[model samples]
Target: MAQTLQEILLAPNRRPKVVEDVTKLVDSEVSDKSGVSGLAVKSGYALIKKINSSFVSDAVDSMLDNFVGRMEPYYASYKASGTGSFTEHLTANSSDVADALLGVTDDRAAGSRRDSVKKVYAKLRPQAKKHVEEALPRLGALVEEHAAAVNTG
Candidate 1:
């Protein structure tokens, strides 16, 4: 089992340093936009939300990897005893991260502060689009690297 909420909240690994900077940058961009009286406000909230989503996705991936690692030894022991197939167990549970992340994107996108962040993305939709355009590639690269590591390891 995992730690309690209090422990998780206090855990050092849960903290990602870059989220604040990203939020601040997005808020500042929103503040510079014209005709939007509270673009900054929305941008701030949206940025937080976007970063939160990203963090959640990253956390899910890490968690599933950890879970699988822990399960492997137990699975091997069970398989050696002729209790079950570790491969079957692994495959059945392997969907944890992928399914969770896809659900987060699909269900949470509508709520990602993604669009809202863009709206305040400096009062210019283009600016927001540019940020997202750049961000997606970076995130995609990270995912690719992470997947490669998992596959090879």
Candidate 2:
């Protein structure tokens, strides 16, 4: 009608139907330790910020080349435009083409893609020096900024 444990701390004689209990002594202090999930959340946020920065920097890296490549035709248009139909007259007669190409117009509305591009060119002095020293620009080998940096590190 009863059983006995191999209780090292108790005697078998009267270890009662409702036996004595053992309890732990808690210090009642809260730990300042953080969990793995919190760390993961922080790291995930950090990674998102890093990814966003790189996306913009990748854009900045191409800013000069792409912008000049775009505006070049307009600058070339003054040379290229003669006079003719709607499209032809549009390129020649529009004052905004020169103004926009020179970064004097609604570039602010375009978020200063023009200024950002100009800064890219302004920052190229060192690379320009290196190419001039290396290539010794001849007649036909005139260095376009876009073509100059090609195949370089």
lDDT scores of the candidates, listed in order: 0.40, 0.30
Cα TM-score per model: 0.26, 0.19
Q: Kindly give the number of clashing pairs for every candidate.
A: 1, 0
Which segments of candidate 1 are over 4 A away from where they belong? 1-127
Q: Give the worst 10-residue stretch by lDDT in candidate 1.
A: 1-10
For model 2, the local distance difference test gives 0.30
- Predicted model with the maximum lDDT: 1
Query: 54-142, model 1: which lDDT tens digit per residue?
Result: 65335334443343344334344434666434334434444442343343334334454556443433353333333333333333333
What's model 1's TM-score?
A: 0.26
Residues 98-138 of candidate 2 have per-residue lDDT tens digits of: 34333421242246444543343344322333322222222
